[model samples]
Target: MSAAGVDSAPFVRLTAVTKRFGRAPPALDGIEGIVRGGRITGLVGPDGAGKTTLIRLMTGLMLPDEGTVEVLGYDTRRQPAAIQAAVGYMPQRFGLYEDLSVQENLELYADLRGLAKGERDRTFAELLQFTDLARFTTRLAGKLSGGMKQKLGLACALLRKPQLLLLDEPGVGVDPISRRDLWRMVENLTEEGIGVIWSTAYLEEAEACDHVFLLNQGRLLFSGPPREMTARVEDRVFRLSGTDGRRRHRLARLLEREGVVDGVIQGEAIRLVMKPGVTPPLGEDESVASSRTAATPPRFEDAFIDMLGGGPGGRSKLAETQRSFAVGDGKPVIEARGLTKRFGDFTAAADITFDIPRGEIFGLLGPNGAGKSTTFKMLCGLLKPSAGEGRVAGFDLRRDAPEARNRLGYMAQKFSLYGDLSVIQNLNFFAGVYGLSGITKRERIELMKEIFDFRPILDLSAKDLPLGLKQRLALACAVLHEPEVLFLDEPTSGVDPITRREFWTHINGLVEKGVTVLVTTHFMDEAEYCDRISLIYRGRSIALGSPDEMKSRIVREDLPDPTMEDAFIALIGASEAEEAA
Candidate 1:
């Protein structure tokens, strides 16, 4: 039934909806569907798929050029103001006043939403309690952690008790624990009979929806239960284990098989997908298997990749042109000996220690306020440790910072580069900074354009490009000098599945060519690629092991076949419980 009434109609309806921005391709084109009410409906697609545009049109913030958007039986074109009042919108970048206190921001939004004063007090009390932010009401919004800020944004959007809630990519950059909390809060809203529309890049999140709308290039690809989508890949998935300690090399070779649809490193095994009606090429010589494997149930992610015609398959071009080097000459590439950082009376990172050798990928997993970033900066010479050692390539980060930094390439989480410059201009500028000159500079720029395939839009402003394209440009700039080590901070935080797989293919290739990497990410599936992981909490390393080993630690009689994410949440919970005791 519709959220607007007791009648049996969908929550929102679209009839040949179309939207265009300037002379570029249509943001949304002739889309039609019905989102069910009284539960969560997921909206998912790749970057530039018009997910944001569709959400805006439904909120009455923008009017469509053709067809109609009907929310709660009221036509958007005729009753936009009424539609706006009934809908609660939490956009990609929710407008929050960082300078104000938490309570002040809530008050401001309540006033803007026209809530009655008598009704405001009770609602404020309930919301603050529900979000667990009552104790922090007097704190400045800027001082809150990333998770807290997300909670505050949700509270502000819910001030007027909207009939329909619209959330646009709400989980970007949020760690798994915080993400779980956010999910729980949204699930509670659905139980109250409130219709929710959630747009996200995380396919794991989409898997939990009661109904899903899958879109591509502004057109509907599928609109139904997520189970139906997942069922398309039945009898197609398998996990190959017991390899010869060359997971990366073997996974790359498996991608070239004609019967294989998609393949990635899952812990010690390579999860393989065979095309429909094809027999498994099981042999004693195959690296993907030690023995014949049974078919595993497919996930929403597998189906999503199948619909996109498999990932960017084949070997990485960037890896083939590069020469291999050996850095196994008696020195570790990165070292953190009891690393610790403090801010005033509080500690950010404490007693963190790890050693990374050449040609290995190490992952850091932690909560938002946890000291992963602090430890990373100390190793890069961006910050000094309070009472510990940080070294890179045998050079002390504090004393020989320039020398250490010169040997590494860093790509920050927020796309830290010149946004106003053209794509080619940014490439040229970064190349010069890395000491490339004359023919070397010209040759490298052309090579980058060819490798990343950004030549078609080379003259476009960097800010105007889509998120995936901007990510490519950032990565190209970081590797212009071909440093021996790569430091990636949340490298694929908000990208789609296809782009993520492509990025990892390059990373694995670089590792094979003797480039060590230290990376951080929120996606658990991606974390399986790490040789070892350090799970931090409250400024300390609470757990350290390979992903498979970590999963084994959490297994019990009541539960079996636990995934990497299950281990992550369970270990954090155990640590929290122990600390409290």
Candidate 2:
């Protein structure tokens, strides 16, 4: 059911809603939207696109400063309790007890919903089967992977079998397989007349929704089916390809030319988008000119990029830094030999081994709690390896731990920025900790502000900034001392596609200048940027190869045009099959 014929009433409706905090500009201004029953409405936008604010208004957590907000035919301000009782909300950072077992958590939520014993038992069994968590019912919530935790949170939210469900970035930081499982669950709910309003920074997720409300800078840009939006750039997208090892340089050149709306290296080719009423540039590089390219249908992200303005004007350029640590001539900059980590009798990472050469982007791909973090911590010298050893920039991880740490930079999964401090203060403090002072520190701070476009939010507390701005702040602090190696743990997990592309642009520039990057990401599309990847499953590196190599190795006759996500799922599925056998 769409907004067209919904019994003269929407499940929830917002009319010219406006909200503000303090003296700052309105967080949401004059927004109009509706959520219909038995449909998935995606609140899609970038970091500070007012998605969360809209959700709060719908749930009656906050009253709009202007206009009216109603849910289930009741005014949010007067009937907040009634609305709250009927809607199920799962926040970005869900409230789940770390120490509580999955079964216990379910019981707690069931009790909160005041369910009888019979109802509780029925609900628990249904949820367990739906979420595929029956085998792990006794496992603590904290011990589950990021995806499992999300499923558990969803199960708890469904204890009351709400009429409407609201999920805020539930797929953030979750692996592809887990994301698929969660979506399937949501799809099942919609069939039961459970309206779902999910907010996401991911464009792909927004594409799957029945309707999309594109919000940006507190304003609604468009509201309709995703195809209606993507249709704007239908025949404008093209794929250009050439000889191997030259795609990046060709992509950089294409982006520099005028009329080129957006260009990215997709697999072995460059996906190009042209501005409206504009043709592909003539007399360009041979790789672009002589290539036999054809127009393809635009993806949701392609239209999103065009809608935001057809150019890469807001991206940051690579910063100038001293290259004192020379790349080991033909030798690996990072080496892991039989690395292992164990907690009690359970091994988090067992006998994992990989060698990363200088200037290469090495990705550690896996589901959450699959030992990617454990192996990362050991490699970075934060946790001692239970067995074997590794080397970082020529420093032995187990021997010269301090030296190893100093030679590299580490960005945690959740940014480690000082939330209480202003952006400038955080940069200054990180610089000081890195031993820079006086003129050197000032210059470094200024450079970071310029590169990351942080001047606008300089005085804002780190916690108050949007997700993209916070990402920039965290990256600036990480590279302050210009370490030879950088470790990014799920850096672009929750960010929008444009922000992620911009982040990788800077990273690519750095790699060209001899910086080695070790990254862990849930976005399979990002695997294309890495020179090589290791797919980890159950504390083991099951597959190690380049993106193309791995995808090609998956001998699945069923899947044509196999992608990184397909390859990853295939490998994990195979591993599970072998273990069962």
Candidate 3:
């Protein structure tokens, strides 16, 4: 099934496909595309951009309102059963029975795919090794970490070795190492001539594919090689970093306002895109005459930002009313001493200690089962620590659980906002529960609407909003009463770059007003926003510091330049090695 052997046939093809969801708009508007044999094609776009709709059309989960879709030369509408039999489809929220063990999940998928018992056993062994799940076969799928769940989901998908693989944001919430492993598996499949159409919001991951289709607001913006698409914006990006935030912010504004820059905020630096002939602004004491021209090629992320009409500049506004809380002699908002949680003989959270300062953004980072959620639960007073002491917002976590819970806003990893309720109704319900009433409740609701741009969807049901908007509404509900501290577990998990940026805007505004934030995220880029971070591995804080401090500590002197990903890999790898020893 090599590309050379199947050069005569396209693995999957779509012709003038259009799908409409009621009268809102066509989710897949005239999406005419083709996937060739032995190639990895990326469907890249922001959330609600029709990537998922296109995938569904090809997978026969939904038929298009117009046109046709074909898989392996079979019409999808007429031959959905044949297409399903020949394709491996993994949706965004994969269906995995929580109660089933890893092995059982794979076995069930194998049986469902109609694999022979012997073939199933053989494939199961290979898949276990490939996904690195052999060690955890007895562990329940629900007990697995976020990365592990994704790996298991893929394992189930690959059980039958279908001719075409359709993955929808397969690496949405996975760690960097897991993502790398998943990509390697995908490359191997494509090498074996199994065509892949991967829909993802992660632009960097999309760069690995052989071809890319850029979708925007249900329209195909560009289709072809990633290199060609990036070439369109080459020599336009300038990397700017400095110690001063005020100066950097000022320069960013100037560049943005001049209409000559395509800027993206990256940690402490600003990646600015300048016009072909424009000169960079010079400081009074610093000379611009000796400034060298930036020759670096545009990254997929840079190109994406340019395509989004550059960054949000002065036009963005911050909330006016201010609420302040003192750290009380700079004491940590949350403090844990020798905290422990165990389920029978299994240790969910080992003896751990940490201090989170008031008005500071603290990041809780770890692999899926690395004790992040357990610790978060303890802090929020949902689960009592098996041993030791903890406090949140000046209330002892164990002794004053109710008091701590009331003072802190908790947004779970799987945020379950009332879908049937209208946006305003959801807000109102949360507001009432938080003790905000009369004009106070009304004022706060209005503030949230303005801050999150929820006015347009006030009367719309929460379930009707897109993923990004849902995340926004969830966040709005969480902050309705303006809790003293916020506990956000993977708040931006699965959100696209644009939505992620917007979410951070609201977060940064809160930080500016001295609202303490304790968040857990799998996305490394978000770790940059935290004032301090603790890298938890196997229920312990193996690394802790500001992003720069952590980077400096872990990066090797031999390496020319190391990124956050490199630092993370080094730290986590070292931790695992020590545990083995």
189-248 per-residue lDDT for model 3 (tens digits) = 888888888889888877898889899889888888898877767777765555344322
Can you tell me which runs of candidate 2 are displaced by over 4 Å? 1-9, 243-246, 277-283, 286-292, 311-316, 320-328, 555-558
Local accuracy of candidate 2 as per-residue lDDT tens digits, 1-581: 53333444588888999999989788899998888888889999988889999998999999999999999888999999999899899988998998999999999888887778988888899999999999999999998888999999999989888988999989898899999999899988887778899999888888889999998888998999999999999889987655434565566667777788887766676778898776666455565666657787788888988998864632336533545445558889999999999899999999999999988899999988789889988999889999988999889998899888887888889878999999999999999887888998898899888888889889999998878888978998988888889999999878877778788777776776678999999988788888899999999999998888888887566875687888999899999999999
lDDT of each: 0.88, 0.85, 0.79
Scanning candidate 3 in windows of ten residues, the lowest lDDT window is 284-293
Report backbone clashes per prediction: 0, 0, 0
Model 1's number of clashes is 0
Question: After best superposition, candidate 1 residue 335: deviation in angstroms?
Answer: 0.2
Pull out the clashing pairs in model 1: none
List the candidate 3 regions with Cα displacement exceeding 4 Å: 1-8, 245-256, 260-267, 274-297, 314-318, 325-329
Prediction 3 global C-alpha lDDT = 0.79
Q: How do the residues 177-276 of candidate 1 rate in per-residue lDDT, one tens digit apiece?
A: 8888888998888777788999988888888888888888888888888999999999999887776658898888878778888988889888888899
TM-score leaderboard ranking: 1, 2, 3
What TM-score number comes out for model 1? 0.97
Residue pairs clashing in model 2 are none
List the candidate 1 regions with Cα displacement exceeding 4 Å: 1-7, 284-286, 289-292
